[model samples]
Target: MKIKGLSTIRQKLMVFVVLLCGVLLGLVWLLNVWLLESFYTHKVHTDLQRTADAFSLLIQKYETLEDPSQPNGISPDFYSAVQQPEYTTMLLGKCIEIADANYNCLLGNHALSSGQCLLHPARTTLFGDTGLPSWNNKNVLAYRAQTLADGDMYFTLNGQNGMRQMVVCKNVADRYTVIVSTDLERIGQAGEVIGQQVPLIAAVLLAVSILGAYLFSKWFTKPITELSHAAREVAKGNYQVRVREPENADELGQLARDFNTMAAEVGRTSELQRDLIANVSHDLRTPLTLIKGYAETVRDLTGDDKQKRTDQLDVIVDETDRLSGLVNSVMELSKYSSGTMKMEPVRFDLAQLCDEVADRYRNVCEQNGYHLDVQTDQVCMVKADPDSMSRAIHNLLSNAIHHIGEDGYVALHVKPQADGSTRVEIIDHGAGISKEDLPYIFDKYYRSRADAGKVGTGLGLSITKAILISHGYAFGVDSELGKGSTFWFVAAAAEPEKSAEA
Candidate 1:
């Protein structure tokens, strides 16, 4: 068995769709993560601002009650006002010339030693050493809060275990620092869960896609499969195998149309072949019947009277010759049909060959009391097989003589063609062949039965046509019912100059 290559179309399509879907999903997920991060940052900032507002209120009350002569440490009221379920608060000095790296926390509910305000990557430029930077680096507010005396109270926040805190400071003189934070690690864990689920979803989708691909491939190749089987049936001489049409009218439809045409041609050719065989059988049997009857009569019933015996013998001889000619003609036609005829090139004189051919039929015409008309100049030279060329001319002359009635004339003529070739025509002034029979006159065993009395096996013109064709000459017939038929052939020049040597 021949091993064809495995199909790749399904694999290619699966890979393409899978890659496209994956890229699209990846882009959407990445966009979702970025948007969520942005929301998270915003939530953190808002929580920090809320804590700062409460701390500012408590600090204002403290300032109103404080004595300027001696500053008091942070009162408990400041931390209490900013306290939240998830936040811490601290009170730093309101009036102290804060050094480059200062830490003066006055009070705290729970504060780290680091006097730093809450900061992420975005805020790291305005607080002391051990302090997270202020929110905006280019602001005079951040600069004053970090460098000037009685600067902003600094708050540092740390997220509680499983919780987050936000730290907020109100202004440069406020002694309260508040921190607030929220749990954001839970969001990361949720994303991990989604990431783990993606491949499982892809696997499920791939399984469905594979099933779909298999079904589609089978469906696509189905028509071709049916066509192949139909062709096999047609080869078995069934012309009725029309393709069962599917809903699709694509290339397969055209193939079906072509297949039907091929089957039709095959069926028609087979019928013609059968008809030809029957015709050939009938054609041969008629002459055999005549010859056999004439032979048996001369042998047994007809007395040995010289004239009667001669006439009967002549009939038998003529019919026998006709049978031989018919058989030879059929053989030649079969050779032509089988493409076994060999073509040969040779040099010979055309006019001499025509003269010889005319002489033979002249005898026949004289014996039958008909005029033999020969017309041509001498030396019509051409390049053709002398034997086949003579046979072609002889067949034409014989046909004319055979058809010419008593006192009727048979004419043989040779002339030069425009293309350095010679044309020979044989004409008979007898009952002419019919128009309908003219086209198939050269067909094997085709005879014009308009005259039922006509003899011979009906392969005369067929053999003549084959002989001329093998020599690359052209031949055809022209006739009217009463005007007789002209059978003509043109022979190519035998290097007309070279004929001088011959």
Candidate 2:
């Protein structure tokens, strides 16, 4: 069964704390009511027993200093020792007596006037009867004395001066009997005081507990509450909302960090989605308009003129091919992103591959008054998917041609390293990429400012990055403003096949 008003963590935490404090307060009250008095009585008994034991040891040590004039049956030195602060404190609020085997009052006869002594009856009516059976009773004394003589300690409870008292007796030096008495009335008094103050203590504790619980719950749940608000905002398409991260390295802090990262990604994806729509619309509308315009020209104007009709039809075919290329780029990127495009790796001369890709761009560059230089005469063997490698090289070449510098030059270099690896580079003497754009230049939808209105899709470099990454080849770019850029990758070389010279 669910209770009301506990839907949030704060409410649940407060309730848990309240229940905890209640259980603790109940335990304190129960201990005070049920076990406190007995515990105090037992403590008093233990204290009296320790006093008796201390007196026995002291008496044994001074048994040789007998003095008939001293009521304690010890000399002045023994009496001075007993007068020290420690011994005096131990003897406070307690009556002690010592006796020989003949039942003589060797010590504590002064207690008779105060009526706290069990061995002697009260001499005055001021303190009334002790109501103790062992009070000046010979039979009880004989039995207790005999038990002490047998090397065992003895203790009993009895009424003294209208209050209960605990008595501990022990044999000292096998010659003297030591008896220590302390009243148990203080135990009763303490229990009564605690019982009276219990309600007040419980009230203060409950108030403090509730306040602390509230503050703690608020502090602990603040981040979570903010995160909830941020999440709701994100659901409503407000991806810019972010929550403050906590200082701790705990799960809450990690969740906050992850949430912020996810929010940033979502925001980026949303921006990319918008960019994709705009770019695709612009790209498709031009070619589609061209195809429609040229088709109408062929239908209406170039009817009987075969030469003009074929030319117009050829324009339509080129525009259609451009549209088809855009579609193919999108589909290929999707395949690469989804990990569904399988690679067929083989050993081949990397330098030869570079030359072949450069050859395809040769006439285009020459026709556009741009130079295509292929500096790959070395035979560097490498193992990789040749088709993907060719695509990567072609994309780089195309990107360079589009951004070809005023000098109208682009170069491809394939250099063999001493480690038997091949380093391939595509250099364009065009306006270079900015450092700010370098880190994300290869992202799926990212394009540098320099390539803002370029003719190609932005997915070229991203597809190249995916291809190289899948092959586990190391690739990077170096560029400076107005100095052009160099894009490169290193491919591990495969062993060369045996020559026919042997």
TM-score of each: 0.46, 0.66
lDDT of 2 by residue, 162-260 (tens): 566566778766677777676556565677788889899989999999999999999989889989999999999999999888888999999999999
Q: What value does the lDDT take at residue 457 in candidate 1? A: 54
RMSD for all candidates, in order, please. Answer: 17.2, 7.3
Looking at candidate 2, what is the lDDT of residue 60?
79
Model 2, residue 203: what's the lDDT?
93
Model 2 is weakest, by summed lDDT over 10 consecutive residues, at: 122-131
Predictions in order: lDDT: 0.61, 0.79
The deviation in Å at residue 209 for candidate 2 is 5.1
Compute the lDDT of residue 45 as modeled in candidate 1: 57
Clashes of 2: 0
Task: Give the clashing residue pairs of candidate 2, or none.
Answer: none
lDDT of 1: 0.61
